[model samples]
Target: MASVQRRLSALLFGVALAGTTLAGTASAHVRYVVDDPADVGSIVSFVASTLAVPAHAAIVGGSALATATGLLAFRRVRPFQRDRDVFADAMADYRDLLPWLLRLAIGIPLVGAGFSGYYFTPLLESDARLLFIGLGFLLLFGLATRLVAAVGLLLYLAGVAVDAVLLLQFEYVGGFLALVLVGSGRPSADDVLERVASDDDSTYARVDPVHALATRFRERVAPAEPYAPVAIRLSLAGAFVYLGLVEKLLNPGYALAVVAKYDLTAIVPVAPELWVVGAALAEIAVGVVLAVGLYTRAAAGLSLVLFTLTLFGLPDDPVLAHLSLFGLASALVITGAGPFSVDELLRTRSASPEDPDA
Candidate 1:
């Protein structure tokens, strides 16, 4: 238990260090040529510059105190009193849903990237857009998924190389990378192949060794049931943290402007600037707690509330944008943080003497 705690502490320290480095970079790029909130890519830079050092210190101090208090209280209780780990129980058959979740997260974005019709222009030109859309459908329908995922991965890699904006958009990059590693989920063509192979073991045994090896290799990268929920939690955590840092903190002026436009100040009975600062602090804290997988249910539930509130203020153009994030937050609330989080570690160590493996 002590060793595990040390390892967890080390991992968390590394993540915090990385975040600090990124924040510094964000701060350096505060001023930009384009201040349009619609651009989205520059939001983090705006946040770092908007919040002064004292403001940052106050928020950090408050979050630390809260986290410490919560940890102490959590230590005193026997929360995981169930026979099994709650996360494992909730995700008993998660593998069955992994493909669908991956498809929605990765494929939907590809579709959006290529969508250029009545209301909006495509992110890519005609030929590229068509190819992108084709890849998206292939992924979504579970048709030739490996080939499509490979192509999509390469395409995103190329885009990142050419356009730095994609690097800043963690959601898209994270989704694409996850698909590349996991391939399509169950009920896809991959499953069909597996079923066919299993149906005739003798025939499969006679197949070329190289082909079998390739198949085995692909399976190695497939998403496992135990980890999918945690992966989703991490992805949402990164996206939210980035948004909180870049979108709200870095761009307080724009945030305040939007709040005023939507009469958010009137609804909350707080000054717009104070509201922006408070919201940013909450967002950042939620992101950090979620990222570390600590009190994940509470953090995600709070995030869901925040996301729901935003829906009331969002214009039509951005309303759809928040829906997926809201869904992710809601899913976390239902699923908890899974095995990859600090909550699980704490629960495991704090198990009673009678339940040695708890």
Candidate 2:
């Protein structure tokens, strides 16, 4: 079941990506001038906007399809009986899971920040963008976290200065810095490196009482192995749920206005009211899946698509608003629902001693 679901997710995502790429490429050929045709600056501006336009548009359609597909998939695999039991067991094993969970919290944002900077042009300079992506990988993998964290800190500070609304980015940088100042903690590649280093011939004297006292102090002050990642995931879930309800259900005028304002009528041929209702339902459905941690990757992947599409309609001040959700969704893509999710429940059931798959 898991394998099949994975394949389905991959197939849907691939189709969306391929379709979007083709559409973007196709649209590029239809020339439209923004200013004097002979002006180099005007030509560049027109070219950039043309290339970007299709992608921004395609993301909405792709996300809507993906979200619908995920909901259908979840209906097929959602564990009806043992979800509560699984959650209980997950909590029981929390101590063992803490390090791994912490890694998700720390690593996902780094990766999200980096990937967004790289893939989304106009966000950063080309060279800096690649560097940002590399930084995410390094941080995600727990390789040279101290150095990566330091770099991330500098980059995020610069980003905040450029666009202060991205306070979340700065917040993440601070978390990374905390890890750098103290340590990457358990299950990190840093710990493995330290372990290997410890085995080398270089010997050190035993710690004195004074040094031990300082170590204790540091431990006391060091950030409580952060759980911000968990909060981010839940917050995303809540935000989307609220948006779905308020924007589409309770007061659809606003949604309709947004759709009309963005000239998104092309994405849906049916009446705007029906499309709005469907979109709202999709958001609510996706939010429920996220909240319950069912098929989280699929849900997050679809959310990523929706968030990407939303960029086109957003005003300048809020243009980057959805970007943070993009990061969270990306992080969830990497981390899934974590230990506290229905996906884990299904996995645990499948692997149970009573099950033949075990």
Candidate 3:
């Protein structure tokens, strides 16, 4: 297990280094062209001219390397190893692909869009807008969960609806908020187990010191369980649902308009439509897989890849989003789907006779 982790870490570090190099280049070129009337256009041109090539190439190379290394690692590690080791290996496998993904998807576009939208629009500076957007999402997320508990089922739907509308207006910030709202609150596995033990006096007294110590060690060293997977899936679902609706209504040609305005056709050589469709499809697929608890580890792996790619493509400013997504993806990759997931349900049902797996 240690060996597998080391190999995975090495691969991920290489990918990250590549992504950072690309991101650095993108950042250097993405200066604010104040002469252009359309701020968005200038930003896009900068991205297309400076950032896109190296970032895209890095992604292609990283993907191949990750795949090859992963195959080699899988062959060496037996499947039915220690449960903790199995979980760790699975997580490492998922995380190894993330750096490249972030470089491609969220990070690159976000830098272009965020700088244009935040700096050129109203009174908000780019950094301030980013903070406000994050804060709004946090507040919305907290409010939505609170509403679900306070107002009951119908109200929960209404709350989600309201939140969705707000998110549509905001885009990435909205998505982030929806994720926070859906996934913000959850006790750690240790907390849950501790609570259970405390409530059951017999269990608490019966837990030997040696057993307790071992369990603590395991908990510290082992990969996370499936809880975060469920949260991320829910968050993705909310974000996509909101984004799909907004894209249809507000700016049906928003992507194209941005592309044409920037003269990206000559610079980037990739159609805006293609990029839009690809990104949308990726997000929708990620949301569906996560929500249904199907191929959760793979879904997480894909998400990590997507985010890592974004990190590379975007400018260096508003570094928080890049860092947050990176950390979140890493966590999901390590933890997988938690105890409440369909994966867990299936495992339980297969092991027992009474319960039907969902």
The residue-by-residue lDDT of candidate 2 on 1-358, one tens digit each, is: 4554355345333422322221111000001111111222343343334335565446556777886786677555545337534544544454444334434555564455455553222333334556756775676666666666667657655665565333323225324434454445566676665555555453432322233443454465344333333333454565565556543455555555566655567876745555555566567676667666776766777777776666543443233323445555655555456544576676786644221110
**Which 10 residues in a row give candidate 2 its minimum summed lDDT?**
24-33
Over the stretch 1-358, how does candidate 1's per-residue lDDT look in tens digits? Answer: 4554455445434533444324311111112212433333455554444354576557656766987887778656646646435554565446456556667656665666556420111222344667767776788787666667667656655765665444343344334444554566676766665556555565864663444654766765543434445555666666666656765677666666566656777786755655666776766676777777887767767776766665554533333223345545555655567666787786677635322121
Regarding TM-score, does 1 or 2 come out ahead? 1
lDDT-based ranking, best first?
A: 1, 2, 3
lDDT scores for all predictions? 0.55, 0.48, 0.39
Task: Provide the lDDT at 115 for model 1.
Answer: 64
Question: Measured by TM-score, how close is model 2 to the native structure?
Answer: 0.43
Query: Whose TM-score is greatest here?
Result: 1
Residues 1-358 of candidate 3 have per-residue lDDT tens digits of 5664455345433422322221111110112211122234443453344335665546545655775677467534524346545565665665533323322223333334354454212222345446334333333233232222222223223433544322221223212322322322332223344455555466764673433653554454243222323443444444443333233112224544444545545655654544443333445444544555544555566766755654454433344423434444444455455444665666565543221111
Q: How well does candidate 2 score on lDDT at residue 189?
A: 74
**Distance (Å) between predicted and true CA of 305, model 3?**
1.6
Model 2: how far residue 322 lies from native, Å: 2.7
Would you list the rank order by TM-score, best first? Answer: 1, 2, 3
Model 1: worst 10 consecutive residues (lDDT sum): 24-33
What is the TM-score of candidate 3? Answer: 0.39
